[model samples]
Structures are given as structure tokens and as C-alpha cells.
Target chain A: MEQWKKQWTPLLPERVAEILERLPDDAPLLEIRLRCDRPLELVFDGSDRIVYGNNKAPIVEENELKALLRRLTGYSAFAWENERKSGFITVGGCRVGLSGRMIRTEDGVLGFSTVSGVCIRIVREVKDCAKPLLPYLLCGGRFRSVLLVSPPGCGKTTLLRDMIRIASDGLYGAVPCRVGVADERFELSGDANGAIAFDLGTRTDVISGISKSDAAVRIVSTLSPGILAMDELNDANDAKAVSEARGKGVAVFATAHGADGKDLRLRPAIGALLDAHVFERIALLEGVGRLTSVTDGDGLRVDAVSQ
Target chain B: MKTIGIALLFALCCLAGVRLGAKKAAPLKMIRAMRAGLQSFSDRTASGATLADAAEPADDAFRERLSVYLESLSQGSAQADAAGRASAAFGASDAVRSGAELFFCGLSDAPRAELQRRIEAFGAVLARAEVDAENESKQARVLRSAGFLVGTGLAVLLL
Candidate 1:
């Protein structure tokens, strides 16, 4: 087996861990999405490929999910209160999304009352996945603000990550720009314990475990990055923050979840950002090897970056 | 020689009675300390302290048990495993032992209020432990004093 595949070892319960290890070597294990009481299925080889780990496929219990979270957060329930409330946390570069009943008070959401499910999205950095799309994202010899669009699980994160690395380390005919990553979920940067587990490249700054909206504005003022990269802009506050940063002339490389270019224009938040000209280029991410539809700031489908 | 021997036995009897009394009383002190530790834990948890950093500096024995529990957790041990290990290391009765486990086990994906509540409930466990320890200690105290007196009376009668 390749050494790179070993890095995807999720901190699963012992029973599931043993089952994962027994998977056939030829199995193209892309992601392992687990939910409480749901049968464990492996995503690989296709858009929705499923591989059975066990004939009985042990049901994931609430206790098991709690155990997993305890292990992932190093048992720091207090420190992870916000993430727990938000229903998502990143551990070892994988985004662990959770589902639970929201516990709110007079002010706002306090935390979760009862945790129910967990989906561990394994982040695989597909190096050079941006090679074809890099041209559309660059104009002449400098970076342009590009927003990656895709429905959830369509490889937007994987592509956006590679693009950031390329822009930070320098790509073909383009100089290495000072890149700042606002990694709210720790998915893009893969940084933990003051040590970067993933090689983003030389001269890349990442701020994790903060709201992307805050990080977007702060990274510009503090890091003064030539290009600001982030993932999943959702809501008016995030759009407002990114627009203000782009107004400062710092090119923003970010992503959003949507079906297509039409969906981008339909979404109220993206429409607001587009009207302000925050994004110069928008690329729609599809399955692996599929072309990414590149559109101009006006949401017009201009060209397709071939895979 | 006989007079000296009687005096020595009497002194030994008195010392044994005192030791028994101290044994009976020591658990109450430990129980109070545990209660204090629970309050600190509640305060710390309410302040959003991380499990690794939430150390309530109580008595030496309590702190030692907490360190073992948190260290095991920090080292990536499962909740039950870490809690069980800490409980096993505790030199106390079932109530205190299970209380230690409950303390660590409650550090799940729970909110500050829930965790604080868990610590609040720990007081009952400490109270129960104190009662059990006190009962054993009281039995020992009675046995020591009464047995010494009975032996001494029998000795005098035999002489």
C-alpha cells in the first residue's frame, strides 16, 4: 500500500477500525461517512460507490459517536463547545460533520442538547487538480479572485486546496503570491498542534478554528496576503466580509456549495457578492475528470476548463 | 515487672483506640476535600475549561486521581478505559471509586451546564462514601476499645 493512504486513518471505534483495515487493497476508498445507527459505507471508485465493511455492518451507536468526538477533540469538551454547537469540526484535515438537536437560550444557540450523527469527510489533497483550472483563475501573470461552486461532495474543497498551494508556491507563468487561508474547518490547511500535517508550500499563512468572515477581514489587515483562500461561503455576513476584503484589492480564492452557475445567481448571498464584484471568476466543480465551467463575475458561463 | 507490663498494655490499648478513632474520622476529611474539589470542578467547567486543563487542585490523593484520569484521556485512551483506570487507582470505597469514574466519564460532548450539573451531583457520591467509611471506622473503634477492656479484665481475674 502507498504511504500516503496511511494518513487517512480516522480515529474510529475499535470495531470499525478493524473492519476498515480489512478492506480489499484494490478498494478505492475515497471517504468513509458514518452516522449513528447507520451501516458503515465506503465511498470510492465512483460518484456514489459503496463498499461494505462487514456483512452485519455494526450499527454506530450514540456512545460510539461520543467516544469518537472525545477522541478527536482530545476530550476537551469545553474548548470544542462552539464547534459542538456548530455541528462541525475538523480533525487531522478531515471535516467531521455532526448532527444534533440545537440548544438555544434567550440570546442564541448555546450548544447541542443531544448529539445524533457524524459524517467524517476525509480530505484528500489531489495535487495538481487545479492545473487546468489555474489558467482561468489567473489573468496575464497574477491571481484573480475565483469562487469555486459545487453541490456538496463534488470535489470543490479538493480543487480549491490544490489551487491555494499552487498560488502560494508559484505556478506556471505566475509568481508565488502571498496566500492566506481562512480554514474554519481545518480542512484546507491541515494544521494542528503548531505543526502543519499537510505541506501547503512555502510562505502560506493559515488561521483555523475561527469564523471565515472574521478571518477573511483579519487576514487581509494582519497577514496582508496577496491572495486570500477559504472554503464554503454561506450567508450574508460571510459575503459582506469577503466583499470588503476584495474591495481592499486582495484577490479572494474561495468556494461555495451550489448546483451550478444558475444556482450561484439564485442564491441571495452569492448574488449580493456578485453585484459588488467580489468574485471575478466562478468555476463549477463536478465529478473527477469532469470539466469545471468557468463563468465571469456577471454569472455568465464563459468557458470550460478541461480536466 | 508485672506492674510495668500492665501499664504498657493499658497504654497500647489507649493508642489503639485513638488510631481507630482517627481512621473513622479521616474519611470525613477526605469527603469534605472531595466536596471542595467538586465545587472547583463545577466552577472550572462552567468557565469552559478544557478537559486537559480542568485541574481542580484539591487534596493530594484527589489530585493524583484526577491527573491519572486526565493523562489517560490526553494520551488518547477511550472514556471508559481512562475512567476505569482512574477508578482502579483510587484508594477508596465503591462510592468514591465510581465517583472518580463518573467525573471523567462526564467529559463527553456535553455542554458547560450539563458538565457543571454532573459535578454538582458528585457531592452525593462523596456523602455516600463518607457514610460507608465512617461505619467501618466506628466498628473498628468499638472492637479495639471493648476487646482491650475485656482482655485486661480477664488478665486481672486470672492473676
Candidate 2:
């Protein structure tokens, strides 16, 4: 078998380009999908370094490659060594599953050691995936709270970001309203140096590096923004903040990782929000970026074709 | 020899004291001038006064000096505008076009000096704006606090 470095090195640029280029042409109009929805397994040592996996084996020495991997993941004290063979860090929102030596304790599995290999999956964000649903959202001349649901790497955040840009650009109607994005992770803006590089819009106010709940309150009260956006809604505090924003009449767009609408409705805080009718539309993304189904408050299917 | 070394040290200390004193005085003077300039600008702009209105009260000699400066600025702006339009029309890259446009549009001689000077002036304006915003918010807080105190007092008296 070819060495991991030899196989991956030549294909790295091509793979990156493919991810960026394969974005749905009718993004915002169609659902942007991920090619692999399954979580990729990542094997690492206690130091969070990549071990090895897939075609790659014979993991690199920790001393020589650990520093490089640290720079990539931005997290220290984590290392992966799969079966003491090969390893590399995965990019974007792709899952990195663990393997190798298991350190089991009475409480639970403490950690993995003597790592073997890892599987790196690529996650891509296609633009304009939500374009078809824009009219339905803005049908009443007022924006509604939208909840986008999908499993991991399903392009929920990508759809949300485009929707924001669209709303800010006023692509559907008048001048874009003020949008406040509470991006806890640097995913939406992809800003490394604490400033938004892209033109989200003149009216967009981005407060990166803060919890969604805190950002929502700050934007709503201080910025007096019209719309609020966030990704990975998990906590009760986040739900509470969303509820408060809804009460204040601010439109919200958020995404979460879930298998289906029913699965989404089962989450504690998420279920509460749904029960309270926090979101006007629940869009279910499936099979990568395909929009499998969309439902209204009554759980009735809305057969709106996306462009 | 020890006596000589002590004397030399004293002389060095005296020299250092003089140098430090001079350095401190210069910065203090600059700070005072900056404060005075800010105050003058604020006073002129206050009470519904425009830049033109403020300039009107100056002596004829000052007005003549101002006119010459304004004329030079206008000519510079004209040249800049021509360059900017040409670059834009030629469909140059964004970097080139923006650089040309900013050179002519953002640096027009109305504010005086060259591009670098205008940028410095803009920085000062931004600083002043921040300070003004801070002061306004502070004043609002004071007013709110006073209102709260009065309301509490009134409520106590009514009870």
C-alpha cells in the first residue's frame, strides 16, 4: 500500500478545492448537502495528536510531528497515535473518532492510548442552499424565527450564513436589516484575527468569540438589531435567550445537529422551544445537503420547491 | 580617587536631572496644546455654529491665507479625481482602483496637508468622537441616577 503522506499530500489541494468548488450552484435556493453524514473516527493519544487511519498507517513519531499537529488543531495537550501507526487532523466540522489503547476506569472510559489510525472526513458548505425557502419565510412581510435541523456535517451552518448574507443584502426585498451573529466558533465568519473579513452587510454586527446566549442579549439590547443568528443550539441558556429574543420581536436563524424533526423534538431545551412554537419553520436537511422535508408549526409538510 | 569618583557621580546625576526635566516639559507642553486645540474646536462648533460661521470672524489676513490653502486643495482634488476615474473606467483590480479612489477622494486638500496628514486628522476625529460618546453616556447615567433618587424620595414621602 502507498504511504499515507504520498497518497494524501498530492490530493490535499485537490480535495480542498473540491470542497470549495462543489458548493450547490443554486445555493440559498437549494439545500446545500454534505457527502458523508457519518461521523469519522479519530484516534489520538492523551496529547490530542493524530494517530493513523484509512489508507495511512505507521503513525509518525510524536516528537517530530506533534508540534505541527498542535498548530493545526489549535488545542494543546491532545495527541493521536492509532495502533502506533499513522494519523492526521480532520478539517471543518467533520468528526474525529478515537481508537487505540483504551484506559477504562470504574466510572467510564477514561481515554485512548497507543493509538493506531484515524478517519478524516471533509465537511463543505454550499451557498444559496436555502434560497427556495426565502419567500415562505418572508411571505408575511415579516421575518420568522427559523430552526434548521440536520445531523453532523449536514451544512446547517452554511445555510444559516447565506441566509444572513441574503437578509443583509436585502436580496429578497428592502435594505437588509441589522443582523447580529453570535458565533461561538470561528466557523461563520472564519475570522482568525478578531475582525469580520467578509462583507456580511453594512447592517450586520458580528460579535465573535462569545456564547450565543450572551451575544444574543447584547445585540438585542445594545445594538437594537432586527435579526439574530447562531449555530449548534445545545444549552438551556441558549434556548432561554432565543425565547427572550422572540418576545422582543427579533427574527432568529439557528442550526442544530439531529437526525430528524422527531429527534430534534426529543432534546430537552430544543423540545421546549418547539413546544412553545419558537420557530416558525423547521427545515430538515438530509443525505448530505438535500432538503428532505420542511414542516410548519402543525408538523404538516410544506412542499415548497427550492430553486 | 574615591572623592574624585563621588564628585563625578554627582555631576552625572545633575546632568541626567536636567535632561529628564527637559523631556518631561516637552511632552507636558504637547499635551496642553492638544487639550487647548480640542477645546477651541468644541467651543466653535457649539451653539449651532458651522465651520463657515467659525471662520467668518477671522481677520482679513487669516482669511487670505485660508483662501490660498483652499485653492491648492481644490486643484489637488481635481487631479486626484481624474486619476481615480481613469483607473476605475479601465477596470483595474480592486486593490488598484480602491487605492486610486481613496488617494483622490479621501485625501482631498480641504482638510489640509497630504494623504498621511489627512489620515492622522481622521484618527483625531475618531478619538474625539469616542470621547464625546463616552461623555454623553456618562451624562445620561447621571441623569438617570438623579431621577431614581428623586422618585424614591417622593415615594417615601407619600408613604
Candidate 3:
């Protein structure tokens, strides 16, 4: 079993862990969600199952859920205040989503007064997954500024991560470059037990725990990276940062939450990027790790084979 | 031989008094260590260390209890329940037990500023208790000297 998968077992209640451990090592588990007094949900690659105890679905007690949160935060909630406010905490490269009674004040969201639900999303490195898309993403033997468009949970981040690794490592006839990753959520370059969770290639420099714009500007000024990789360009600041970096002669590999070019243009920030033709290639993803098609910045179809 | 036995008895009484005095003074020392420990813990937590990592610099007794609490947390026990169990280690003092329980409550989820504020508030409580402990320690010293004088008087009367 992958170490990341094993990390979840210890955080779960004993009975749930026992039930989960019964699955095969390669069970393709995608998520483990726990709700207070509700049945445990296990999401696999293509299916979801509810685990039962005795005759009915095992219930997650309130205390058990809180304890799980404590363990996830390493029993130091003060340290993860920002992440808690963001409604998620990353542990061992797995993004644990939290939901509960949010305490709000005049300033904004204070934090969770009581966490009632937790969703642990399992993430694994799909090595060389970007190999086939490399040809289309490259132009004239040089990497193009590409934007990966996908719906939620459609593996846009995973593909973008693999693409960054491939470009940084210069593997399989790809151009090598110093890649600066603006990991706003720490999801791109997660840490597990004080160690880097994923192999992002030797040339990748990651800046996390800051906004994408600040990290991008800092990376460009300090590291002078040839390529900048960031996940989820959602706001104007992100789009402007990517545009500014591109203008400065740095190629960008970014992912956006959208299904196609139409979806991309529907959002104000993404539409501006599309209008400016910042990205030379726009790759659309359907299903997990499957590229459906590729289009140019002008919305013209780029004939390419899906990997 | 009888005189020597009387001297031995008087010496034993003085020794008992010294031991009792030391016991009375122990709380003051313990509280001082706890204050220092909490400062260190705050520093470590500010630097993004887990409670287990920060617990090493705590007072010996509190560290052991905190270890148990952390172990209970790892075993999936609720924060309140774990703190309840850990606070039982301060069996001799209800004030200390309650203070410890409050210290452990919701600490895992407290923000950095809130944590610092809590520590300062707890430090105030500890400061007051420290004053009380210091007074008790002084009283204990007086009690010990009185016991020694009483022992001497009894021995002289016997002579």
C-alpha cells in the first residue's frame, strides 16, 4: 500500500479502519468521508461504497470526528488556523476537507466552532501521465503556455503536477527548465512527516502558504524560473500574475476549473486571459487523467491524440 | 545509652520536619517550572511544532501527564476526555488539576494569537498561585523551625 493510504487508517476509528483495511492494496480508493452519526463513505475510482458494522452502517461519533481532526492537525490547532479557516487541511499530501459550525465575526470567518464532517481525499502521483500530452503542449520544440481545463475532481491538478514534473525533469524529449510552483494550498508540493510527499523533479522550486500573485512575483524576482506552474487560476489576481509572468518571457503551466473554452471564457478572469491569448494551448480534460481534446488560444481545434 | 536514644529520637523528629517542609515548598518550584515550560511551549507552537514536540520542555510531572494525553489523542480520544484523564495526575491539588484541565481544553484548535492570550491569562492565574505557594513555603519553613525547637525542648526536658 502507498504510505499516503496507510496514513488514513491511523486517523480513522478502529472499526472503520478494520473495514477499510480489508480492501485490496490496489483498491483505487479515492476518498474517505466521515460525518457525525452518519455512515462512512468510501469513494473509489469509478464507484462508491458504504461500509457497515454488524447489521447497519457504522456511525461516526462526534468525539471520534473531533479526534480525527485533532490527529490531522497533529494536535496543534493553533498552527493550522489558516487552513482551518480555509475549510481544509493538507496532511501527507491528502487534502482533508472540513465542515462544521463556522464561527463568524465582523472580520470574516473565525474558524470552525465544531467540526461535524470530514472528507479525506487521497492523492497519488501518476508518473509520466503527461507524456502523451507533451507533444501538443509543446510548439517548435519549446514549451507553450498551456491551460488545463477540467471540472471539479476531473484530475486537472494531477495532470498539471505531472506536466510540471516532466517539464522540470526534461524527461522523454521534453525541454528542461527551472520550474517555480506557486502552491497556494500546499496541495501541489505537499509535505508528509516533514518530507516532500511527491517527486516534483530536481529543478522545481515551490513557494506555498501565500497567494499566487505574491508567490509568482517573488519566484520570478528571486528564482528567475524559466517556467511557472500553479494550480487553479480562479481569480483576477491569478490571471494577472500569469499574464505578467508570461509577458516577462516565462512559460506558465496552469489549471482552471472549467470544462472547455466556453466555460473558461464564462469566468471574468479566465476570459481576460483567453482574450489576451496568454495560453497558446488549452487542453480540456474529461474523466480522470484523460485528455479529451486540445484547442489553441483562438479557440481553434488543435488536432491531437488523447493519451 | 538512654541519652543517645533521646538524641536519635530528637534527630528523627527534626528530619521528619525537614521532609514536611520540603514537601510544602515543592509546589512553588513546580509552578515556576510550569511557567517556564508554558513559555517554551508557546515559543515552539509559534514556530509550528506539534504539542508532542513542544511537551519535552514542560515540567517533569506535567510532561508525563501531557504524554499520556497525547497518547490518548493518538488513540482517538476526545480532547476533553484526554485532558480529564491527564489532569487526574495532579491528584494532590484541585487548583492545579483544574488549571491543567483548562490548559488542555481546545488547545489543539486554538489560533496562535488566542493561544498566546490564553497562555498569558493562564500565566496570571499561575502567578497568583505562585504567590500563594511562596507564602505556604515560608509558613512551612517556620513550621519546620518550630518542630526543631520543640524537639530540642523535649530533649532538654528529658535530660
2 or 3, greater by TM-score: 3
Interface RMSD of each: 2.4, 25.7, 1.3
TM-score of each: 0.71, 0.48, 0.84
lDDT by residue for model 1 (A203-300), tens: 78988778898888789899999888879998887888788778888889888988786687788998888777788888877765355578888878
The digit string of per-residue lDDT tens for model 3 on A1-307 reads: 6665477787787777877788888888878889888888998877899865667855688877877777788888887888889899888677889988999999999899898999988887888888879878776546889999888777787788898888888887676889999987778888654555688988999888788889998998899998999899989999989999999999999999987888878899999999999999999988787888888999898875322
For candidate 2, the TM-score is: 0.48
C-alpha RMSD values across all candidates = 6.9, 24.2, 3.9
Which sections of candidate 1 miss by over 4 Å?
A: A1-10, A24-27, A45-58, A299-307, B1-67, B70-84, B87-102, B113-159
Docking quality tier of model 3: medium
lDDT order, best first, reads: 3, 1, 2
Work out the iRMS of candidate 2: 25.7
10 residues in a row with least lDDT, candidate 3 chain B: B87-96
DockQ of each two-chain model: 0.34, 0.01, 0.60
What's the C-alpha lDDT at position B91 in model 3? 54
Error of 3 at A185 (Å): 1.6
